[model samples]
Target: MPSITVRNVPDEVHRALKVLAAQHGRSAEAEIRDILENAVKPKGRKKLGSLLAEIGRRAKLTDEDLKTIEQVRDKTPAKPMTFE
Candidate 1:
């Protein structure tokens, strides 16, 4: 786990955070963590795997189609980049 130091927050913001924390039955630090988490990683965000699955569904792809693709697909590993 990592911690951060947020410096020079306004007094009003600090007070509001404390009040909000009290209302939510948590410490202000926990409230801040929740706020930060939500800001960075929100609930309604679309993930890549889900979006790709949705696209496959829209395209009416089936297991047989996937198997066909896999049968014809290249199996070689990509070479790593090199600098001389």
Candidate 2:
């Protein structure tokens, strides 16, 4: 097993980590280990384009249906954003 030493961590960040660790009923070191593990691990999330493609595939939409959808979408104007 390999060990790592992290230095120069900000006091505010360290304090926050300690507080979070205490809330989770674990030591700060264990909390940090868990955080690192989660950060490095790959999360499963399907991309929007991929999901849409899959749905389109299952629906078996015709080329004319897709063309009509694009034509309708292009005709709709986008709403302007208002900032206070």
Candidate 3:
């Protein structure tokens, strides 16, 4: 297996990784690895409305119900996001 080394890791990023690891019942190292792969991926993110609609489906909402939900969720505010 190949190994990768990352530099310039800020303390806040490290701490966030620790918390994420705990949330997913994984070791910090494993969580950091998962975070690294996901963060570096080239795939485009789902649109906020699409993600919300999927969540609604998982929650067993009917399509007629999800139509209204998507409309409302799409209107929800978008916070300023800066990818580190």
In order, the Cα lDDT scores of the candidates are 0.97, 0.94, 0.86
lDDT of 3 by residue, 1-41 (tens): 67878899999988988998999999998987897799988
Write the residue-wise lDDT of candidate 2 on 1-84 in tens digits: 889999999999999999999999999999999999999877987789999999998999989989989887866578989997
| Candidate 3 minimal-lDDT segment of 10 residues | 68-77
- The positional error of residue 6 in candidate 2, measured at the CA in angstroms, is 0.6
**Candidate 3 versus the native: TM-score?**
0.41
Clash count of each predicted structure: 0, 0, 0
Model 3 pairs in collision = none
Error of 3 at 62 (Å): 33
Q: What order do you get sorting by TM-score, best first?
A: 1, 2, 3
Residue 26 shift from truth in candidate 1, angstroms: 4.9
Candidate structures ordered by lDDT, highest first: 1, 2, 3
Which residue runs of candidate 1 sit more than 4 Å off their true CA positions? Answer: 8-27, 41-43
Which one wins by lDDT: 1 or 3?
A: 1
TM-score of each: 0.67, 0.51, 0.41
List residue ranges in candidate 3 displaced over 4 A.
39-84
